[model samples]
Target: MAKTNLKTATAKQRIFRKAINLLNQIFFTWNNGNEEELVSFLQTIRDKSPNVQFQKLIASSVPFLNAFVQNQNSNLFSRIYRHPFIQGYSLPYEVGNTKLVHSDWLRSVLIRAVCYCSSVEDFNLERIYLELTCLTNGYSLRFVETHVQHFFNFFHLHPMRYSRDQIMYNKFRHNWFNYIKIQHELSDQLQQFDDKGQLIHLNYLYEYGAR
Candidate 1:
């Protein structure tokens, strides 16, 4: 019984070690972009583990997580990617959720679409899809329009859909890195405040019945 248990434990450890090594290789391939190395690594994986499968790039484009990455003329571009199987599905029903929840969800998704889409055309396409999804899920036209406008305003862009300029969008994308840096600085400042006991952390729950 002891020997059997030891063998089972050793097998599990070996599987875990292999999984970690595979993840490291994947990350290295992603960062380095060595096609030949990736091909060889994938072939080895397939030979060693027939059950594991990988989808190869098609037409220099591949879907990764929620975005589609494309290599075009030595330049890399990306946009929001939706699975074909779930293309017909609507977002969470607006009527079933609180207004705050709906607003937050819409804003978050719009932000993601903006960040992921590298071109104006892709962004506009995603925007239209989001609008249709929200509308089909019982969101009011006015509400959708308001939030969409607010998103444009937050990024200091023209609110009109047709007025979206590629130059302006590119400028916004360039400035986004600076915005992230500022956010990191603010986080560090907050951490300093916490360390100095100058900031208070509060956790409170609102009681709807009391309200």
Candidate 2:
């Protein structure tokens, strides 16, 4: 029969399915087979709440928010997830939206693709998907190419369509130290404005009696 499993880390809870003899059994433990009682104890409090609901999935892979997580041999992997209906849909480039909006949107999508995909192959697929989506939404070819190139540069990867070197990709993948270092550097650089100090605040003031 199908079994449900719940893994909790900090504030996030991920639920997946596994096949076992126990029917409708739910495991609330880690890979080490501990913490089942802690989760069960917490469940009592949740049961007292009327607004909360519990859901179970019967698949090895499930989509949780913007990421698709897969359970392989009890190990969890994740990748970017986009709904089919919303594919290729974004604020059209030809619209009156500011250039910053368009650029920020693309950058955010690329960042999510890089951070979410567990494998280089999955990242390449997400890159292609983003390229097509941007093109279909009227983003300029050069605009997309330049931003995508910057994304690779941010990761210190060769700006080719795909990296043939798995070693380079592993620096960002399996190595948490290197991955976090690059992310911290990128965050620091992005926060600065035109070689000045980092932006402190942004305020929007309305004209009094002008509405």
Candidate 3:
């Protein structure tokens, strides 16, 4: 009976390790624009039994998984500390500060939108922009719309209005809005492909900068 218990513990550890590695691969794909392999890997991880504790890993992996999944452009953990929505939503309200309210609405909205960006190619730059705009207090559709306009203007594309800028909305209705501007920006900024149009190093930039 003791041996069986030991084996069970060992199995859980293995699950934990693989889940951690999968999360790392997801992060690398997002930052480095390696979608094909990441999609395949994500599918494999998703196919694992729902009872395997993958969701639990995401919740418990702390600084690592949070950094891996959250705002990759910013230090993910740092944003959690200062973000207005998080500040509005975090627990342990001060006594007599009954004005405080904690709600998961903003986080849920952001996560669902991110999941819509399934591939590196499909991941739109506006998704990040809208997410940042939405995390602030009393964020209006106009606030998100302003960034959408700026994004398009930067690319010399026609700006989208608040109603047409759907990435700010919940995921189900946030379908493509003929917003080719975002796709162009992502393609232009893709790190793996160089100016001369060649595939660059997966890890070279990190090593080169470390020297």
Candidate 4:
């Protein structure tokens, strides 16, 4: 990467980066084990910012916050994956289901909100960028899962919809699994697909399996 104006010419970026510099510290101390720290950060942002959508999300997640859990794309290092693909969000619910996968607006909100909770400026950029990139292309980096369940539950979604690997056979997949039937038309065709190719093919099956 070339040296850019952000490092030298932009005063706002410099100050903005300084304001978030606290994220580099990891002295996260808690008293009484009640998650008052996370709660406080959420409250601060919700109370200070005038954005209605941001306020709404914070309000929903703070009270009912759950212990972070890993989803399919997550490894031991990265506990959190990005929100579920927008293509499948509509299958079960109809509210707030925007095409947020590429929305800088939403990601920016999430970065600040999560960093507030974390109280650190240092973060795993590769994993965040992985989220911004479509997963089928594959990424070696991952992020510790955040309170995604808070967001999902805020929307009243069943955990199964987003927990892709939790379904261990017996048809624990999408809600439409029962409807998949092979017609005689394509049964006789001999198709060839390699291992990675199989996943690449799932893009065509977005409705049934979104990876």
lDDT of 4 by residue, 1-211 (tens): 0122223322322122211223321111122224564465435544544341222222212221211222223221112233444342121222452233323333344433332222112123422443444333332123113233333343354353234332221222222223222322233232433433542433331221122
Best by lDDT: 1
Q: Give the Å shift of residue 58 in candidate 2.
A: 5.8
What range of 10 consecutive residues in model 1 has the weakest lDDT sum? 12-21
lDDT of each: 0.64, 0.60, 0.36, 0.29
- Give the residue spans of candidate 2 off by over 4 A: 1-29, 34-41, 44-59, 87-89, 92-96, 159-161, 173-211
TM-score of each: 0.63, 0.60, 0.21, 0.18
State the local distance difference test value for candidate 4: 0.29
Which segments of candidate 4 are over 4 A away from where they belong? Answer: 1-101, 109-122, 125-211
lDDT by residue for model 1 (112-204), tens: 776778898888888888888778876688878888887777667654355568887777666664775688799999999999999999986
Arranged by lDDT with the best first, the candidates are 1, 2, 3, 4
Give, for candidate 2, the lowest lDDT window spanning 10 residues.
1-10
Candidate 3 global CA lDDT score: 0.36
Error at 21, model 1, angstroms: 20
TM-score of 1: 0.63
Residue 129 of candidate 1: its Cα lDDT? Answer: 83
Off by over 4 Å in 1: 1-59, 87-89, 93-97, 191-197, 201-211
Better candidate number, 2 or 3, judged by TM-score: 2
Model 2 C-alpha lDDT per residue in residues 1-211, reported as the tens digit of each score: 1121122232353433322233443333233334574456347546554444456454678776667877788777778887777735565444543566667777777767766777778888888878877777666788778888876776466543477455666565555446656777887777665358655666773331100
